[model samples]
Target: MILLFQQPELPKDQPATETQQYGFELSDFLSENIWYLLIFVLVTALVIFDYYRRKKEKNNGN
Candidate 1:
């Protein structure tokens, strides 16, 4: 178990590389999921707004 938990040391001269670039890509992600697919469960306000808008339109329509 100790052997599994222990990590091998790396050279002190170089920094460790990151797998991903951090921070959100708001525009592309928001457009792809929300605007196109309308995955409403992710956002509470959007779900509520969509429900109200649909209800209002259904009631108001001839």
Candidate 2:
């Protein structure tokens, strides 16, 4: 079991290679999902809110 967990040693003669860095940014997230998708989601949320608000108001009035 210990042998299965052991990592093979890398040769020291090979030169190190540069790795590309990944970073998160607001613009990247917006572009990937599409900005209009986010806006429509917000509008849908507002509509749902107004629906519940009206329903509560009608119940209280009766």
Give the alpha carbon lDDT tens digit for every residue of 1-62 in model 2.
89998879966776544332345667677789887888999999999999999999999999
- lDDT (Cα atoms) of all candidates against the true structure: 0.70, 0.82
Positional deviation of residue 39's Cα in model 1 after best superposition, in angstroms = 12
Model 1 worst lDDT window (10 residues): 15-24
Candidate 2 ranges with C-alpha deviation above 4 Å: 1-33
The prediction achieving the highest lDDT against the true structure is 2
For every candidate, C-alpha RMSD to the true structure in Å: 7.3, 8.0
* Residue-by-residue lDDT tens digits, candidate 1, 8-27: 99657765344334444666
Task: Report residue 28 deviation for candidate 1 (angstroms).
Answer: 30
